[model samples]
Target chain A: MTAPNASPVQSRPLWGAGKTVVLLVGAAILWSYLGTGSNLLLPFQADGRHQVALFFSQLFPPNLSASLLTRALRGSLETLAVSIMGTLLAVLIGFPLGALSAYTVMGNRRFSEAEGSSAVARLWRRLIYDGSTLLLNFLRSVPELFWALIFIVAVGLGPFPGVLALGFHTGGVLGKLYSESLEALDSRPLEALQATGASTLKVFLFGMVPLALPQLLSYTLYRWEVNIRTAAVLGVVGAGGLGQDILVAMGLLHYQDLATFLIATLAIVIAVDFLSTFLRLRLIPS
Target chain B: MAPSIEIENLVKVFDGRVAALDSLSLQVEEGEKVALIGPSGAGKTTLFRLLNCILTPTRGTLRLQGCDVTRLSEKSLRELRARIGTIYQQHNLVPQLRVAHNVLAGKLGRLSTARALWNFWDPRPDGDVVRALTQVGIAGKYWERTAALSGGQQQRVAVARALVQNPDILLADEPVSSVDPALAQEIVSLLADLAQEGGKTLVVSLHSVELALAHFPRIVGLRGGKLYFDLPPDQITAELLSGLFTRCEAERGVPERVLRGAVSPVFPLDSPYDKA
Candidate 1:
């Protein structure tokens, strides 16, 4: 007989779904540690600690010279411009793709159903939906760094390549996010619009746009914050930003200059975060 | 002239098993004001949705102004639906939009895509939007965000939205079920009076027998996807109401509360509008 105090939840076996997942993750971590031959205690070792200390000591008393500061500032500005341009382009490319991928975002009321309608119409919708999903998957699967490398080859180095790379990668990311937000929207308002005999475009504008704008903007702004950091790193591939300056300083053993550039990157990232947060509050209702 | 709506042997089965509406036949003549009353699961919403052309009948014919809705093209169906304005229980207004924009949504069918988008941003102080709002007595809250309004005020906005549509037939699916009895009576009277003024046909579903009996000339009672009775308010007997309510409540495992005279149903309204 079951225990008198046992509830259905308490009756579950010891190896429940939660415990199984925890065990699997623990096993995977152990396997990875063994496979990679990683040394967790290396930093605590005497010789390794001395090397780490020497590298860190070089990072202090960062160069505050006017020339280096000016260069760092210019690089930071370039990175900012790249991120803004990339984000703008991403919106342009992603908005339509995102809308097309989500079945609910589209205007056809009949299309919402699984049955009825001409086979040809259904086929067309299916193709568009699948095609958008596939394209978005491909675009995002390739990292921004890889895209930067490709664009550098095609357009020849500098901020333009960085812009194109971030645009391509972030467009995919934003499109997926935008489609999810659109799908997650409260459908009743949309149905109310559709019932009014409004055309698909009109329904989208009046119903979907109003409901989705704040959410879509929030996603785009958050992505912009991420793109700023990526834009800096794109400079490692000669795509142009503070990362290039940092890379040069390191290559030449100019740790002081590297330190200054690192600080500049940190300052800019914080600035963008603050600005995006402010804009989110001002534009989107709580 | 053709009747505003016609249904013959209408049947709607959800997921091929659960029938929301059965072989029901109904006809609403031009400019008629009808009330639908039944228990919670009586398929009143299904009937309204079928009338609005949003839900297709599984096996029957539905005609709007003599147009066979099932056979119509998508484009043609939309044109037909534009003439039917529907008010939902939740009000269904986009919460983030301005009250004026929600009201102007009634004109979406009439406006082109570009014009509708333009209107969303800068609604020309067309006397129509202002006039519709004024009629509903919320003209002062035109630019206010829709969510900021109270439940009763939101209901007014919903009415204003329907008015702006200038539809030939108005379908209100339990429009006042969430409001208090006093506000419910006011809204019902307003809808009936508006329909009379515009000479538009109206079909409103109500949980309150008293509201239906007082404002509507004819009442249609439904039970379990089938019509129980179709009669004028004077012909409806207390025995008939008690039988209907008692049987419905018993099926839901609630103790029977017999109807006496014109008393309305009492709801547990901890917070109005929180129900939805």
Candidate 2:
């Protein structure tokens, strides 16, 4: 019997495969120069490898002295405090901005003649929405490190500066994420509440908040984890934390002390990550 | 008593192009129970939205409880809306909230903002809410998350919320479409009974011609965004339904067989209930 007729198969290259490879190779060359202060070719030199080996050897048998341990513990506690305060402040700042920025929550409902018909009302609503979005974009666009430096100058070097920096930067991030979550929510529930004559605030509280809360909380927790690491880095600019201790150790060429601080920072990060994960799993239903 | 709803030349054009409702006009007496029946895209939803004041008419006038809806200020419109309760096809309860919280939301319009905020935590399931839940046969689910409820039960919760609102007029937009056939009949009957017993004016848009005919005394048929017939159920004969739906063939430029095939299921010719 003759084989059943089948359409001829055609093979095509994956979309943008050649361009992606070229981009990746170019990025690698650029990144090597930026990260190593040397071109890709220089890293393969014999003397370069020996220099790396010598630098790494200095970190062996990390400082385990009682005095160093005490300093590390104090720095670790300060870092934790900075992260918690920063995250709390971020939530306080971000939640309202996010609610205001979300189109479903604050934007004029399209096709709603009462609210959307008038030119002035529409313009007012658009201005509020666009203004809030612009503010969030401005806040998040500046790096946290820059904010930390600015705060350091304003407040004088301390954990306060680190907290403020993380709070400002993370507030923007959380606001963006929160608005997205709110916008993605089902509008039917809000309509149901509105049909009952609930005011805008009431509708948001009863309808939007319930649906958006779990995801918003999840994002907050994730940001807290990120802030913990960011807070540690802020200390490099003399914003108090483990990063300050690490910076000092590196300045003094105390490689062992630097190694100890690095390990302690890693441990703290892992612990915070685990705790946040546990809380998230418990709090947000799958 | 003032009519529950009064419409004159109501028109709703979407995106300034597609006319969803075309100069429709009708009046419903206080406490009257009526069913709106139509094929898909027949302006039933637009009419319901207009009645509920969720949508403002592009043209013409709609008066509810003798008040001109188009002329009302935002504050007055809200007060008017507070007197009218609407149930959507999807239950529209916050899935993350407990059933009691969803039911309690009905009182948000009347409660002060501070009190409403306080009630979010307490959600005391006051007598009215409990009674409404009981009326819908879901009192036991008061503390359960709304998302955990099945489709029919969620619909029941929605009904309970509407009942708690205790509005003068109730509008349901395909309230039982997602429910199974048996449950659909039961829910419609429940809504009808509740509306009658409470003396609330009821306007329900339905996809099922049989359910509308079987339950409602008055049937309003709509097609191609225009009123087809407003008659007592007895006057709605099979021939009228066939004629009403078949007109779409000319408007849509679809073949006769295809139109007949699609429309037959919605307005069946040989329905056993027709003889009853």
Candidate 3:
């Protein structure tokens, strides 16, 4: 049993990439386990954790109150309308313009003509793309609440401002998404199309559109989901929807009312999620 | 028909450093199946590009079917390109589209924009697409996607596309390089047939000297962006080939077998590329 001078059977050395990957995964899980949105200190979480427990307990006495449920249901409908309108507008307006912006579709001539070949032209294309990106950042950055606050000032407190805010930001985000999709396409078809005496828009409409449709649909659906979330928070700034009703209930110390709002919001979100998933899957090619 | 092509004092420089084509002048009469043979860096593709107006010349004039190619605009170039069919080594068929669509793309330039876009009403090359496919021996596989076809079949589709165009002049850039010897011979024969019918001029750049000698009546040799030989294929001696291949070695007369016929030693297999 006298083995040669080999360091005792070190249990597979714990050294290669698989071990590294497992260790990284374990570290991530451990970090997620320890962290909540707030600090690890006990004081701030105690009250919130208690509220969650109380809310769970109230499930038996689940807010079966009829009139309150009806109002929450109505608020959910408003949220749906805001999301649909915003997404439709984004898809309708952004698709064609996005195709025009792509180098794959437009070629060096159209691009160089619109911009140029020099550093100035490169800077120009970049500046235009960046301007749109900045606009998207501005729209998505303010977190819907601030937009609703600003809109509520001018439009005087309603779901109209919430819808407007959603439309504005979603349009910007979708436009950028669509333009990038156009850029990533195979250029050969567009070149073939353009070389056939087709105009830029015609090439986009015929050649690029059908090819890019799946990407466009997926991005639009994603934006719709985002808009639904944004619509819920609009009430925080008095832009309207379920948020407004929830805000009032919270102000009145209506814990049971809060429960009803949360349940309705959850139901609406789940429904939208299911519908969007089905649509995106259907729109995607096999 | 007038001469299929006429190039006079054609000069093109890319980035002003590389002389892609230097004062290159050439002409091909109707129904002439001319083969251009050259080594790497000999400016074969550059000449094709300039002839088709895909790239403008830095200096000189080009005339196709007696019209000044140098004077054409982008739109006119598209029309000119339709008249002059080009086949690349890669067969350049849009892989995503169906073979039918790619082949019928022959009508893309000839038809109105709306007709081409809608495509439903475009009967421009309706029966011609099928006929061309039949000629290329892939008539049965028209509806399939282009990628589904083999390399030989894809190249046949490229030829079918050009045939559907019903072009007056055919320009092929190493059309057989992607296929095997048997298929290469068949393709060369097909080009020869196109030229024979109604005097269509077929100009092809070939990598094989044997194929060129057997299939082409006229051969143009290029060396370092300059024309070295423009003579009858019957007169294409091994000495001339060696000169084209190497200026120093060519001064001595070549061996008899080479002068008679040289079997291209590249691949062992000979004849039809694989079946469609």
Candidate 4:
């Protein structure tokens, strides 16, 4: 028999996780009561709407005019500018915050002592992340067309307003991304830094930031690609871009020209995606 | 003649339910090496936390070198932290950074914040990093990352980091408990050397009583938030150790392997540690 005092600790299941799932299911049921079942309020233009036959005919021509391709290139440039500006803004702001947002001061790490005493710090960190996340949710929640519409009123729609909206919205997203990367970092370095008497901030920059950087930059670039697409749609709000030009072409019933704009946009987005993927891979240390 | 650390009725409660450290009291003379041993909960870890000033006592007195720490301001407390260096059982060294960076970290509290930030980009600082590494017998691998080394080497890096601080008091919690037999002895010997040769007052909490008695001349046995035994190695009899395993018949035997019925000489005067 073991020593009398060496009794096993009472084994209990971790109850908190089970209760959260139950609460989620209950909340969903309660929320459904206030709403109508039909989703007809959504703006989904069904198949038979808006020149269905003629629109296809226009698309069949697939505007490949040399002169038109060059004009389409200008619109693509605006898209590129939006993605570049948005991703840069997001990366610069998000990277450090991601590290701070991590569980471990060294990026998503679980330190022995920090795990016990850092509940308050953890709450504050989660609050900062969730607050920024809500901001991004609000921004993305409003479709690019809405942002463009508002910006058209405030700043006179151009690629500029599209860039502004993407920068603000994606900045939040990238921050969350970067913080996640920061949190997941190896914590030993931070402790090593701590042993030397380095403050929290110093530990983050030296130990956490370098480790999370490639992933943070990569995520920001991916967001930039989305921002570029959003910028194209924002043009419909008088926010000047390919979207505005497409609007004019459609309004004039220039099916061939609209086709050209669509094809060119697809090509540019593809190129941007390819380049970003390559660079992100290259930036990581093996 | 001054006491490096003084404690009286130190208590710590977590969630106001679990008493991590109960009303405990102790004192450490300047340059003396002390090994604290207990089963698991004898409040050894909590007492170390209290002495390190990382965790404040809910109700007690802690005076370090004539300074009343119970009422120290935030700035004064941080200054106090800078003076006391800590080494954990698991070397909490950052894996990505070079060994030199971890060693240089020991100087951070003494450096200005601006200088510290600048060091992140450029961690090298002349002979300071090399000298620290040399003291720990890891001089050739300063450029390697902290994790690339074996467990013992990493612990040595931790020692180098602490040595860089030039601390007045060294606190190592379960220092060599994680390593293998030979390496554990090496770590204990290093810590002992730090106390005797370097003359830094050191306090280490350990689970192995053999390692404790083998190295430290002074051993403080804790049981249920009380001191079960506090005596020099010369005065420690089998009967005193019997109180430690009062209820366990199997564990009550003399565990020292140097010689049967041997007490003090299991510890050497030149190197007071087990070889194997």
Candidate 5:
């Protein structure tokens, strides 16, 4: 049992795909740097430092006037509502689509053929899978800001449009995450149930659903955190939230008011992040 | 009555090249108890899967009761599958779910999709789940998390799942492999007696030749996806047993315990069939 090539590891070439990837990544970074005309020292130059100091000076002494404080509070509430409602809508739209798009959720034709499923049943499964996958692709491809613009035109300007924008965009994101997690679920339990003569639907409901749920919930909570950030800025397109107030302050040169809204945005994002992280830990422990 | 299981020159090829089962033929009479013994990769599990109708053969014919499974309609195949139960070595229960729900999962074939989904959230008290748990001596852990149970107890839960299915045929694929030897003997005896009392045809694959001979009336030895010997326990000699496990131990992936078991096939003749 003596090895013919005891030092096989050392003999083998180490500079292959790993080095190629590092070279490609390095090239991409260099290309981006030149393409964007990025200047690393720009912020450290004298004029650059003065500009930065002026910006910071304006950012302080936030408007703590009672009226503006009340407005900020209202804006925060609106942003929170948009995120929660948007996420709820996303789940309603994404869950079914995600389930359909998952590779393992729909029984494959070979198994179905063995079971003697009709041609029509097979076609129906194919259609749902392909259709949902394409739909999710289209939904997520467009940015939330773009969706907000379209939604604002259709529904007129309000938080409702922002909710719709976030819903449509995040639905695609959550749908993809949901499908991947579902696809990655351990197939053993599902196969075992299928062996018991359970219908595909029965197996899915009992086996796949239970196995994938914790991961799905974890993904959804994570997506909700992302949606909060998007919702805050969705008002740039007149979709109404803390973002609209911040934009108005920026346009009017109300730096103090802008500072208050920025603080409010950060506070809300941090709050939502903490809440979702808590929920994920409590609901889906590793 | 027609044989409960019939396989005529069944061949199952994996990935177009690896023949998991090659031209293997076997028959089990109604209510007969059979144990399959072999090295790892001997196609014992593959044969069980084919019998369970979860895996279709690449060639040859397979019949359950009297119906050819290959020709059964989707609905008919499901109906046929409902009449068979399987217990795996890993006991594939959904760990996040309650034990009672996992047990009731055995009845998914009979339950409507809506009802099955509802049962997960609201597992209404079912006598069969309770009875199966009681039969396997784990009734107290019905509402407990499945993952919370010990390995041996989890195996019992798997047996409970198969039992709750109330099928006419039971396939146990190395169901007791993970447990200690004493618990393995207990589970094997439990499976044999349950099948006997219910008059269901039982087929189990075993790693230990001693357990197979001690519990089952008929022994089937598989090697390299082919049958080496099929004989009553008393008729199986040490030479034939060794041929199945030792000749190609390294190449065939025969585990050490199997070779060890082959060395000492002697066991007390306490098989229920002996009483008969």
Candidate 6:
């Protein structure tokens, strides 16, 4: 067969080029119209712009009084505590769930023709796998704010509820990440372990966990960083911490106090980001 | 004495379509060293996996030390596997762990969970692991991370791990394939020597027919999911190897020269078994 005389770059339209451009432009226009219709385009109206400008003007001089500063410091510390505790709890809850949900660890035996295992045993394993996955999905699907609200109703308003909220949601997030990393690991080592007659738990602890540890630790640290931000937001539901302080200040139109709390939250987030990044790099090295 | 391994009419069909091993029958006596040789698609690895109990045959029985593997319970299988060690082409060591820990992993099957977890912190490099590492010439580097070692060194570590297992049969599937050509011969020779000295049955799969002929006393040729020949090394001939490799293609009615174009050129140039 003779080779066709074709140019490398054929004269054809790029994939989805025309349609994507049209859809994007149309979406932008629709968004703008919706914004105006819903009175969300505050700067587009004279009265609304004045109100916004006045609001910003009031927020400039932050309340750095001795009493308020002390309160804000205390709230910030609570937020930090909530984040750390929540992250720890999430790791505690997620680690096993992740291991159980991972096909490499838990579901591997089911697919293999495990000698002398009855149908009932296989059915039980299948149920555990499916149940754990469903639980993780349900936990992650509900927002942290919703969790805080539910906890507040159950346990009353406190930083404890906020911690539980963050822990539950972040647990799901960490579970998914942990399972994916575990599943994606080189299975050869695990296979070698299995061939040596190592039990499932032994294989997991010695073979799978060691290989996936660095990635799992990195993911956990990343989730901790996210939980710090979520913890601040969870406080808005009166679960305690800086978010609650911000909500109280907003309710009383204490814009300066709100500005101070916002600044503190940003500073805390930046600090945690720096710490998590340093830890991830130093430990994982890759 | 019972044979170390016996497979009768073994068949393995993957995905219910491709037959990886077809009605293969073989037996290896205790302390015997055999080499499995064939092209890429041959069932050498499959046979090794079956021997290691990593894979189950679709329609045949495999007896390891007179124990019918296919009929054994999970607990019995575990006990059976504890007596058979497998080495892989990639070495299959946990790279981030220390060599001592990797070697000690051999005992995980026998150790209790508490002891296993404790061993991680204090990888109690007992006499056996030390001796195994010493045998592999990496005793001093036991505390070092396995990833820091070179490819050949890593494979030696794998050998040490298998050694620590103290198995009756060592199944190495393309154990030297990932190493450089110079080290390949040394690794194979080391494995052969270890098996001989320890009186352990060794079955290795090799891509190079020369290596197989040089090291192993017996060579089993597999082609197209079936055993082509099982003979002593002295009986292997150039014509036999060429015929074994090209038989599947030739059976389809293609011309022999056209199908053997790439492989035939090298057969006369360097094959040590050409004269035999």
The residue-by-residue lDDT of candidate 4 on A144-241, one tens digit each, is: 55655676678875777776666666666776666667655544445445444455666566666655666666777678668777777777666666
Q: Write the per-residue lDDT of candidate 4 for residues B93-167, one digit (tens) a residue.
A: 766567887777788778887886676457465487788788778899988867688877888888888888888
Q: Identify the superior model by lDDT, candidate 2 or candidate 5.
A: 5
- Model 4 interface RMSD, in angstroms? 9.1
Q: Over the stretch A163-220, how does candidate 6's per-residue lDDT look in tens digits?
A: 9998899899899999899878765677788788888888889988889999999988
Report lDDT (CA) for all predictions.
0.83, 0.83, 0.70, 0.67, 0.84, 0.82
Instruction: Residues A128-157, candidate 2: write the lDDT tens digits.
Output: 889889988888998999999999889999
Model 2 alpha-carbon drift over 4 Å, by segment: A1-38, A41-45, A116-127, B245-247, B250-276
Least lDDT summed over 10 consecutive residues: which range in candidate 6 chain A?
A108-117
For residue B140, what is the lDDT in candidate 3?
89
Q: Write the residue-wise lDDT of candidate 3 on B1-276 in tens digits.
A: 557788888876654555667788898887778899976556787677556555566788778888786565555666766677777666356675678877766667687667766663453435887899999998888688786789888989888877877777888878888899999999989888887885788899898989888988789998766789999887888898887887444323532212211111111112211112
What is the C-alpha lDDT profile of model 5 across B1-276, one tens digit per residue? 789999899987664656777899999998999999987667776677678787777899899999999898888889898899999878478888889999988988878878777776775677888899998898999899998999889999999999989899999988888889999999999999999999999999898899999999999999888899999999999899888887573444543222221111111112210010
Return the clash pairs for model 6, or none.
Answer: none
Which pairs clash inside model 5? A115-B74
- What TM-score would every model get versus the actual structure? 0.91, 0.87, 0.71, 0.74, 0.91, 0.87
Candidate 5, residue B82: how far the Cα is off, in Å: 0.9
Ranking by lDDT: 5, 2, 1, 6, 3, 4
Q: How many residue pairs collide in each prediction?
A: 0, 0, 3, 20, 1, 0
Q: In angstroms, how far off is A236's CA in candidate 6?
A: 1.4
Evaluate candidate 2 by giving its C-alpha RMSD to the native, one decimal: 6.7
Q: For model 4, what TM-score does chain A reach? A: 0.70
Q: Where does candidate 1 stray beyond 4 Å?
A: A1-23, A107-118, B248-276
Q: TM-score (chain A) of candidate 5?
A: 0.91
Q: Tens digits of per-residue lDDT for model 1 on B1-276?
A: 999988898887765656666788899999999999987566787677678777778898888899888787767877887899999887479999999999899998888887877877675676788998998788999999999999888988898899999999999988997778898998899899989999999999998999999999999998767788999999999988876665543235421111100000111212222244
- Candidate 5 clashes: the total is 1
Chain B TM-scores per candidate, in order, are: 0.89, 0.88, 0.84, 0.82, 0.88, 0.86
True contacts kept of each: 0.52, 0.53, 0.07, 0.28, 0.62, 0.58
* lDDT for B180 (candidate 1): 85
Docking class of 4: incorrect
